[model samples]
Every structure is written in C-alpha cells, then in structure tokens.
Target: MLTVQEIRELIKVVDESAIDEFTYETSGETVTMKKSGSKAVAAVPDNGAHTDHPVDPVKNSQPNIQVEQTEVSSSDEKPIVETTADFDHEIVSPMVGTFYASPNPESDSYVTVGSKVEKDTVVCIVEAMKLFNEIEAETTGEITEILVEDGELVEYGQPLFRVKKK
Candidate 1:
C-alpha cells in the first residue's frame, strides 16, 4: 500500500509530466488517475473489487459543483437574489479513503466551521486499507465549511473543506 505522501508525490509527478493517464495496482488495491485539461481526477477501487454495474468513466466523472443560494423577497413587486459559493481555499483529499471528522467515535471533531487552523493542524482522518491517516490543513486559515459528511467515502483530490485564508 502506498502512503499518502507517496500518492501525493505520484500526483505531482504526473501533473508535471505529459502523462494523460496512469494506473497502479498493489496488494489488491488499484488506483487510476486521468488528466482532464489542467486538472486530474483519481479513483481507487478497494481490493480490486469489481462493481456489479459497469462504470461509465465519462458519466461517473465527479466534478466539483458550486452551491448557489437564491433568496426571494416578498413585496408589492418581488425579485430573486442569487448568490454563489465563494471560498479562499479548498482542502482536498490527498488519497481515496473514508473521511472521519474525529479520531474516534466518541471524540470531538478536530476542527469545525469557524475553527482557526495553522498549516500543520490536523483537520481530519482518512482511513484506507485499515490505516488511519491524519490529514493536515496545510494552510493558515479558518474553516468556513466542511464539505464531506462524516464516514463518507472520499476520492483523491476531492475537496474536504472550504477555508478562508488568513
């Protein structure tokens, strides 16, 4: 199994090079990465397990969606106001794993919305192949939002938090 740092290094190398696609298999785990224009997306399947349904890579591509909020005012003449999500920074998952907001079931979350964090702060834990990896903030900021719910499966490069950088 590749460590999170190793996986990150692989991603960096691939991004710096002209590789369009890359795949690696180790100890029954398979990681596939594909580059789309300037960004790269990764998928790691557990234990080389095959899904019952065939996956359509194009249709299954998970794109980041910006949440839009609309507000309506009631008056003699009413108009709708639209707003889009905006954040200074995004903390993305470095590997495919199950996201946990805390170290243990009974423990408090490492950080919550409005929590101030340093570059080395541990914001969450991601479990992969029975190993619990503590993920860092990597930037000085205040967390504005937690994107993934607890115990959610996260893909590599998936945004886990929205932060307002200091």
Candidate 2:
C-alpha cells in the first residue's frame, strides 16, 4: 500500500514527467492514469476477480473522470499480507492532499514509533486547498508505522498509518 502523500507525489511525478499514461499493478491492485482528457483509470479486484473501473473525480485532483469495474467471486477468505507481523489494520486517507502528523512545523508529532490510537482520535492533519483537515484514526490499535513524512502531498484512499490491533 502507498501513502496518500506518496500517491500525490506520484501524480506530480506523472504530470511533471510528461507522460501520457501511467499504469502500475501489484498483487491485487491496478492503477492507471492518462494525461489526455481529465481523469485516470483503474482496474482493481473487487470481490475476487479483476475489474476495470474509473477513478473517482472527487478523490483525484481531476474531475469528471469515470472508470468501470467487474466483480468476481473470491475463494480465499484472507489475503496474505506481507510485512512486519505486528500490524493488522491500515489507516487510509479520505482525500487527496498533504499529510502532516503534527499541528505545525514547530510542533511535535501526534504519534511516534509506537503510538496507540483509537477511533476518532486525531492522528494528524491533511491539508487540501489551503484548508486544514483533521485526520482521525478510524481503528483502535498501536501505531506500527508511519508511511509518509510531514508536509508530503497525498492522494485519496492512500495508506498513511499501519496499526497493530491492541
């Protein structure tokens, strides 16, 4: 999984790189963006099979983009996760913007290497369009890792924090 900031940076990279279309695929996820008209396209495995879908305009900086998806049946119950065994939950970004784990540049971060959090806990702030949006932990767990640094640009649905269920 990638942090929202990482995704934003990727978009920036794509735009700056002067590429028309970018496609990336991992285990069960596929992301593609075209710089011609407006939005990017995505192919993701919804139930179990690969599906073609358009990226949401509200989530991406570009609007009026649409993709389609095809749902398939999945036989497996749990996916084989690869990482340190301490974490079980992932905290994801709800919008495309910048990520800051603290209030400001001069303030200490909300959590560090092993911070514990709960649902509704203010974990950090994501700035979008000059507006500071408070990002809260939607799951209760111990902080296993922080995916991005402060002041980094992020994208919608990106992973920001990995948590270990307490």
Candidate 3:
C-alpha cells in the first residue's frame, strides 16, 4: 500500500509536469491519476482481486497503455463573462475546499453586502485536509454581493465575493 505522502508527492509531480494521465498497478492495487485544467483527481478502483505475493515477472505482463487526444470545436467552447457591472472587484478562492462564512457556526459572518473591507481583511475560511485557511480580501472595497453561500464547496479561483471599489 502506498503512503499518503507518497500519493501526494505523485500528485505534485504530475501537476507540475505536462503529463495528463498516470497509472500504476501492483499486486491487487491500481492507482490512476488524471489532470483536468488546474485540478487533479486520483482514483483507486476495486476489481475484486487480491494477491498476497507479487506476481512472477515472466508469467505476468504489463498492460499496454494508450493515450488519446481530443480536439474541441470553437462552437463547443463558451467563454465566461461576468454579467454584473456594479462590482469592480472580486474575492476569489485561493484553493479548492469547503468555504465557511465565519470562524464558527454560531458566530456572525465576517462580511456581508455593503461591508467595507481592507486589503488584509479576512473574508472567509476554506477548510482543506483538516486545515482551516483564512481567505483575505486582497482589495479595498465595499462588498456588493456574496457570491458563495456558507459551507459551500469552492474551486480554486472561484469567486467568493463581489466588491465595489471605494
């Protein structure tokens, strides 16, 4: 069995390199890693097979791997354009995790619509891997809208709050 640190290191290597997919199999365990945009997903599937000892090299052969590339048409792609014209600045999430509006469930929210904030003001918290990371507003402005709700899952670069410049 692979350790958590080993799996994390493998993910980091795959993310930094140009490789889109990676697969490894040993005994009864198989691990697959794939990159989609800026995010990476790792999956381990169960084939209902288990082996205590390693298979003989001469008896067992490695499976052939094939890589396929797909092209997207111009019509199939849709560009993302912000429709709100009132907000001049947006507070975006720095990592993929669960967004929290306040430090605790019973506490009041950090900011709301019409709340003025400075560059270093913490707007929310993103919890990832048992770590609570406070997300700060990198711009000085008044929050015009809250883009994400409390306890919502957010992706990296996802807009969390819309702010109107002072």
Choose the strongest candidate by lDDT: 1
lDDT of 2: 0.58
Kindly report the root-mean-square deviation of model 3 from the true structure over all alpha carbons: 13.8
Per-residue error at 119 for model 3, in Å? 0.9
lDDT of 1 by residue, 1-166 (tens): 7755565566666666899889788766666656767666555543322222221111111234211111112112112222244678888775666778877777789999999999988888766545567788989989988888887766656688988999
Deviation of model 2 at 108, angstroms = 0.7
lDDT over C-alpha atoms for residue 164 of model 2 = 88
How big is the RMSD of model 1? 13.1
lDDT of each: 0.63, 0.58, 0.61
Reference-based lDDT, residue 89, model 1: 87
lDDT of 2 by residue, 62-103 (tens): 333322222213222212234664678887766655677777
Which regions of candidate 2 deviate over 4 angstroms? Answer: 1-85
Residue-level lDDT for 165 in candidate 2 = 81
Better of 1 and 2 by TM-score: 1
Displacement of residue 32 (Cα, Å) in model 2 is 15
Model 3 agreement with the true structure over 1-166: per-residue lDDT tens digits = 6543465566677777898889877876666767767655555432222122211111111122111111211112222246655888888765545678887777789998989999888888865434567777879999998877787665445678999988
Ranking by lDDT: 1, 3, 2
